[model samples]
Target: MMAGTHGQLWYLGMMEENKLKTSEGTLEKARNSEEWRCQGLSTQRSCHFMAFPSFEHVITMDSLCFDSWFTPSWLDEEPARNGFAQDGNRCNDHALPPDATAFVTILRNCAKNKDLRKGTKVHDDITKMGLLEKCSDALVTMYAKCGALSKAKELLELHISRNLFSWTALISAYAQQGLGKEAVDCFEKMQRAGLSPDAVTFTSILKAYGSIGAADKGERVHDEVVHQGLLENDVMLGTALVDMYAKCGALAKARQVFQNLSSRNVITWSALITGYAQQGEAVQAYACYEQMQSEGLFPDAKTYACILKACGDMGAKDKGECIHNEISRQGLLANDFVLGTALVDMYAKCGVLVKAQQVFENLPHRDVTSWSALIEGYAQHGQGEQALKTFEQMQGGGLAPNEVTFTSILKACGALGAVAKGKQIHDEIARQGLLGSNFLLDTALVDMYAKCGALAQAQKVLDELLLRDISTWSALIMGYAQQGQCEQAVTCLEQMQQEGLFPDAVIFSSLLNACSHSGRVHDGHLYFTLLSKKYGIKPDLEHYACMVDLFGRSGHIDKAVGVIQGMPFSDNLEVWSILLGACRKWGDVNVGRWAFEHAIQFDRENTAAYLLMADLYAAVGMHNDAKSNQALRMDNEGLKMLEVVV
Candidate 1:
């Protein structure tokens, strides 16, 4: 049972980790994964990279004594007395014990290398030398940096002379592991122990607060930082504060913090920009990017990547192209796959598929995100065949599709009405046991089936979902309405309401459209009324058009005219066109001419107005009876000119 539970946890943890992995992380890991640079009197983990694989194997060295190893000359208390020069280059075969500087220099190397096997050997030597108290801080740092948190905490607790560095190692390690509550608990205990935290410690705790969305505690930390005046000199600390607030969705606080910072660097500005981008505030992000550049601070690759995201979201094609040019000038895209992916995503979103494909083809390498971006762009832009081709290429490249990849491909399938392909994807989703976890995938499946006119399959997918929201229900209801199954659409709406899901404006639009197609004038009006009354949803132009269409198609010419006159705003060309079509149907000569005149006044360019008028004359079979036949022919000539101009 324990083994099975462990397996389950591992599987879930791995999936979550993979889902959250992005372009920004793996870049530095390529350079900093194995190297650690020491810069301070107190020990510090690698600032560039945080993740380290846990080392499990333990090496026993019972035959070796504590004082049996020779160490670096710097660790020697009196190098001259030991016949070693200050900048000594010593032979390795010498027989001096490596344990004299056991507290720092040796453990620093172990932590730097993440060599737990050798670190454990040194641990035994430290214990045997009766120097555990003296060496505990470095030992704890070693364990933490080696990805052995339990051992680090065990060593930390057993030592009576623990310092701020020891506590910080554990806190930072917990933060890196995403154990925010544990990090907070450790921080409180360290404060209780009377060890004041430094800037590094504060940065780690702010990251903890951000990870868990504990903005309240983070604000308190901000107060403490302000009380200490820590932000006066440390740009990194202020950036962390801004990042914390941003991650907590407190954009105002983040902006306030950013504005208040005494010194702003590229990283500081990037932190604020990234915050806005992550919150979907693309305009703000773009504004900040412009401001950042005007300050003469060139953006780093990560900043460029983030700004690309903002451009993609806002569809700022020209700005995106300018940034792309700058990126090319810097030669940043050659080695940076993330930047390349961002470029593809930006162009894809802008509907500039040719350039997007060009950038994609020129990319040095591509990952799941890069491929997924192109696929989603293709899917959304109505290039279903291209999306399908990209998806096949991604598979041929040996990339197993994640939830996002599958969602994009499923949309492509839906757009193409490829139900057989959708079902194959559905079976794959089921076999992977991926059905119950991601709700977007759930909604996409239902939407795909509904779009393909496979209403039964769509409904079954919805029913089997562990959790159903308005979106899933909306997909099914829309499917039924679109397939002309009006009664079923109405039934689904009631069922959704019974499940305590209030209909949104979109659902009402679907309902009204269903009523229109079925010629259910009474039902359509009731829904349109309820749209404002019970639902408090303001019926937009689309809803009004549906109502007009409903009454007009049912030969209720007066009610259709009433709908047009009762509209809260000016009727758009579509509404007038529908009313004109209705007038043609019932041969209401006066109303038809009035509708046409009003429609043409609002929309002289569209040929629908002229077409509807002609249809009305032909429908009444009263070409000679109508005096406007000559005027209609003149309008037809006007339409020919309009078409040429268009």
Candidate 2:
């Protein structure tokens, strides 16, 4: 033997010993020898050497040298002989075995390789080799992982030997692509195919149902899992059931399942806590979180997020800060966008806008939600200009505003009556394609216009809306009434009723006020009667005041006085004054004297009422009586009646 470059021993004398001077050539003699039998350059070694040790040391030095002497050019090339092509030299020894697992392994490897071209080639090779019949599981998994679900389904249907694993693969693929309903349909088909799903299959189906909020289907799946006897030892199944029920607002059932869980993990705690948070059961949510920690279970990011949201909903600012402290102590505050956003929202909702702003400023990364929280906080606090400025800053910070941001700022503008800035926001909303949205955003738009006193613009928006809710109708009706457009207001009210929406208190108020402004006594009376009779809407003080004004302006002094007398609460000085002013206007000395005296009794220092009474006395051609009434009015009310403007 001789040493090679790395000091590895190389056999030197074996070639001469194995060679025989036969009738055939030297090559034929070598091929016929025991040393050369079953030996050749392997394809695997040609591409990349396997780490197997020498297995043919008994072979001659020539064969050993042939194995060792590989060319760099042919290192990744096809195997050849004597610089010539050789047959059967590059065949794989570990070619796929003819079974279900082998083909499944091939498909799995193809998916792991992420090379679709190679995957398809391997698939075609399987088809050509007639392995498709035995390879359905592998093929289904292959097509599923490769994102060819339709092809997988076609192949799955072609085979009569479908299993739970095959069904799970297809369902998981659909779930991965967010086609939750399709995943559910595959589960259904699997059940119809008489395949009993395992825990993984059940979890996948439950997750699909939960994703689309299909609570009933999720419950059905839970029952199916129980019926299959699979829930006895499955922690994952229990947790997933909790999550499914929690997401579907079945909090009571979720809690029942949670309590029945033999063992609980962080995910189980998170599921239940988040369920409570979403239901706005902040007390219960915090209690469960405390229980989770008391049992020596550490809270994770999802747990913190749930509790923080509970704080936001319940306005527990102090508790939210405590949670934030824990989060910071645990060193999880930096990357947790969900928890961070929840903190921002909690502070904002609790009316601690300063803390909310501080938290928002400290976020390492802010999304649309972060900006929205601050915008809403300012708008809610009646800081309209500040809200608008913050919105502009968010845009300057390169975060595009979403619908909530726009609605918040528009509300702020509406509060301030910042007509010019409101118009700019409307323009920007239109430019951003948000003007064409449905009810919520449309309602904000109409409100902005109406509050800014641009009734024509508000009505134009109303005209463009494809659908109108009670809010849209209310916006228009209130808009016209605010502008004192009486006929237009009544028309809107009639149209609202025609659309099958009963008028609420706000709508009725607008209609009554319209009658008061335009002096539509009959229509006002009709609406007032219907308010109590049909709609069971009892009249408030504002409604009665408008009715009194309606009759008073039309010179119905006695009727106005009668209406005031019939009011639930004792009539105030304004009601009696309206009656007295009407009496003076119509030269009714008898009723004017009675109304003036009643007004004086209701309020002695009623300057307007005293002035109206004196005028009434003068109008009845009793100069001395008028002067005496004016002198008494001044002496009693502690002022000169001549100085009263009315």
Query: Superposing all C-alpha atoms, what RMSD in Å does each candidate have to the true structure?
Result: 12.0, 15.7
Q: What TM-score should be assigned to candidate 2? A: 0.61
Model 1 Cα lDDT, one tens digit per residue, 134-224: 7888999988887789999888877743578778988999998889998999898888887889999999999899989999999999999
TM-score of each: 0.76, 0.61
Candidate 1, run of 10 with poorest lDDT: 5-14
Poorly placed runs, candidate 1 (over 4 Å): 1-107, 113-199, 211-214, 624-630, 633-646
lDDT of 2 at 631: 53
**lDDT, model 2, position 126:** 75
lDDT string, candidate 2, 512-558, tens digits: 88787777889888889999999999898878877887888788776
Candidate 2 — which pairs collide? none
- Which ranges in model 2 have alpha carbons more than 4 Å from their true place? 1-215, 222-231, 291-296, 418-438, 486-490, 493-646
